[model samples]
Target chain A: MRAKTSAALNRSELEEELRAIGRRRYHDRHPFHELLHNGQLGRGQVQAWALNRFYYQRSIPKKDAALISRADSAELRRVWRQRLADHDGDEPGHGGIARWLNLCAAVGLERRKVESLDGLLPATRFAVDAYVHFVREKSLLEAVASSLTELFAPDIIADRMRGMLAHYDFVSNEAMAYFDRRLTEAPRDVDFALEWVLERAETVEQQESVLDALRFKCDVLWAQLDALYHAYVDPGHIPPGAFAPQDESTDRPRRYR
Target chain B: MRAKTSAALNRSELEEELRAIGRRRYHDRHPFHELLHNGQLGRGQVQAWALNRFYYQRSIPKKDAALISRADSAELRRVWRQRLADHDGDEPGHGGIARWLNLCAAVGLERRKVESLDGLLPATRFAVDAYVHFVREKSLLEAVASSLTELFAPDIIADRMRGMLAHYDFVSNEAMAYFDRRLTEAPRDVDFALEWVLERAETVEQQESVLDALRFKCDVLWAQLDALYHAYVDPGHIPPGAFAPQDESTDRPRRYR
Candidate 1:
């Protein structure tokens, strides 16, 4: 844990501390990622990941909209508005969520099932909704700081794109389009957010909230994977009403294999 | 999944459906509970459960307060006020939270650490906070329906009390007082809330929402155990900065035994 210091950190010091949290707490460090990246995950496992992840992907525009709704200045709103357009797109069946659904479809899930989110792990909904609620209700600076997870996202996205392509025949260039787009989109978004947070978080307590906000976001991401690993990986016992792999028995016998 | 029926059911049918949800989805059925009630967990695991559960215990009054804030009638507010009193007590160190702290003390956790919630699992915070937000934000019928899980609580509390007292040497009657108290409190609370829900949820859509709300609350409880089971039980990898057992190396090596 970063020592709970009362003193305010300098620009670089705060940035370093944020990066350290990413190194330690980001979901990229989660073991499920190792399984996912290395292609040790079965096809159904990958499908479950995509299907559940689609909830997070789909919530981006909503979360961004919530943040935009809370933005005080036109410049801040203007900067954040790009997120909505990027995620929701200018026209029907475009943008990140559409691309994500396409990815889910490529993984063999039906379009309607993915859209309805009928099969989602309730834990996934809880975590993602918590993120959106955090942005909408917390102080705007803390809201902006929550998005700093994007500062670390590009690397994980790149690693995911490379790993999925090499190990899984089911994954294709088109299927990985969501991450490909994020590679460019995330950096642009993070640059403005990081600068805004660094400039605005002037006091020690504000700086700590900034750091804690990022930590909360990391937990949001990491907890999703933990749920996946528990339900679909080791000791797999998919919760009642969650997505069970089609080929597997729906009984979800609770034994560690 | 309770087949999503569009047709409104009679009172008895709705009640039966609600009870069926509890049968299938209550956190009491979670494996972590089986482990807990059966005394399969180590002391550190038990401590982790209490420390994490304390977050949920502390939030009950806030949730009731939110519900009361939204209530349109004096009777509703007056009835809900009792929950606040039960949890928060008349003064400092007097309510259910204080009693919970004593339980935590019985399990050997520090009062300061428990109060600060410094050692809490981030997932625990996320799940608990989601429940509070649901009550604050969702339609009042849904909020009232969410408490219907209390309909199932007395049995679980009874089992928990019996099992903990019989299985764990560290436990005492006084330590179990919170559950002992909850057994009476939950049934009384559920009686009023369930009757209110049965009366208010008049439309088919609203009835469906009531069932869904209970499902959501069960997920809230079950997700907490999922976090605990993942971090303290199988394939344990305590996330960075969460409470790690003192006897265990803080490194929290990821391999499952």
Candidate 2:
């Protein structure tokens, strides 16, 4: 029985170790990131990625608000409110979501079409919805731990920003502006979230839940890219209702109006 | 406005059109069916498909129960109750879900692992959950209409059962018993559901809503296969936490037990 008790502590250590698993294995290191940053992807691929990824950006604030509403403590809610502002911003034509729209436009997707998410893959929608549902249903510690993926995001954003400006002809400092803010925002966000997990995950079970949350979040991120790579990169088996890449030489037909 | 209005149809015609949609687009024609029936899929792929698809079958009774609970009329509830019985069975080890477990055991998966859904794709869970949510939230008429996918299921089951026993060396009549029962159960349920939709969808708006329900049901079915194809059949881009196919020839040393 004492050995079993010691095993429980070992399990908590194992759970913290699994949280570190996300830092190494998540898509922050995927080859597509390298291509996306280096501007090596064709305009069509870039358009596809941005259009598909817009769904993720659009959902973040909604899920964050969901988490905010579920928080029982004022301090927790107060800490969570920053995500809402970061995504929605204080004024029109600002915030993370708008910045994502600018990225979409820069990549050549029509603003209306991008906003509609008509062209986004169903898998992307499913993955994002799964994330939202996880936040709503899982324990608050796990919900907060899921966002710990942000702990690793700042480094990727730095790589992406430098790579995009150097490689892509269409990219401008203004159009690639989302990453610039995230460079600072992500670290601040990550610090608070990491501290929250380390401080609050006091039990073996809580530690396991937090670890599972990060793993779930990693799956969420990886599934999005898997859909993108499958649809746009490899066999390119585009499912029905997903976004179709526009012909490089052509534009939206006038008759669509 | 007049051109848009012209597409509206009377109730009988709308019911026929909705059934026609099921006839044309259901999973009966999916290549995976051909593969499964012909015994062409390798054992691992077959195991992967069954493990993943169990998530769908397991959720059916829950969704049916939700629909049954939402139903206002006794006659409607009585008709819907058959689906619950079909899936859940009169006792343990007798119903569709149990029969599905038998199939899993025949394929060599441990019953506990299969039950836990440890290996199922994340997208499969989301798609199944989406169906349950649709039934819970939509109008009763639409929920009944969604089950009209069963309108197409009987024919597929006939082909599947005959083909599996004829072609698959590993399969037995006992192993494929789930399909045998579904042959009778699906048609009976579908006929009642079709009549229910036809009788209730009197308004043009109601008719359109029923059609939309069938479309949504089709999406649910198609999305499940899409996830399967993406994960197991294509390049096998298995998402994190999903079941990974094991090598049959080399049994790994058991670490968990």
Best by DockQ: 1
Off by over 4 Å in 2: A1-18, A29-40, A249-257, B1-7, B23-25, B202-205, B249-257
Task: Put down candidate 1 lDDT per residue, A31-90, tens digits, no spaces.
Answer: 999999999998789989999999999898888899888877999999999999999999
- The TM-scores of all predictions, comma-separated, are 0.95, 0.89
True contacts kept of 1: 0.74
- Report the C-alpha lDDT of model 2 over B155-202, residue by residue, as the tens digit: 788888888788766678898899888888888887888887888887
Task: Give me the candidate number with maximum TM-score.
Answer: 1
Worst 10 residues of 2 chain B by lDDT: B248-257
TM-score of 2: 0.89
**How far off is model 2, as Cα RMSD?**
4.3
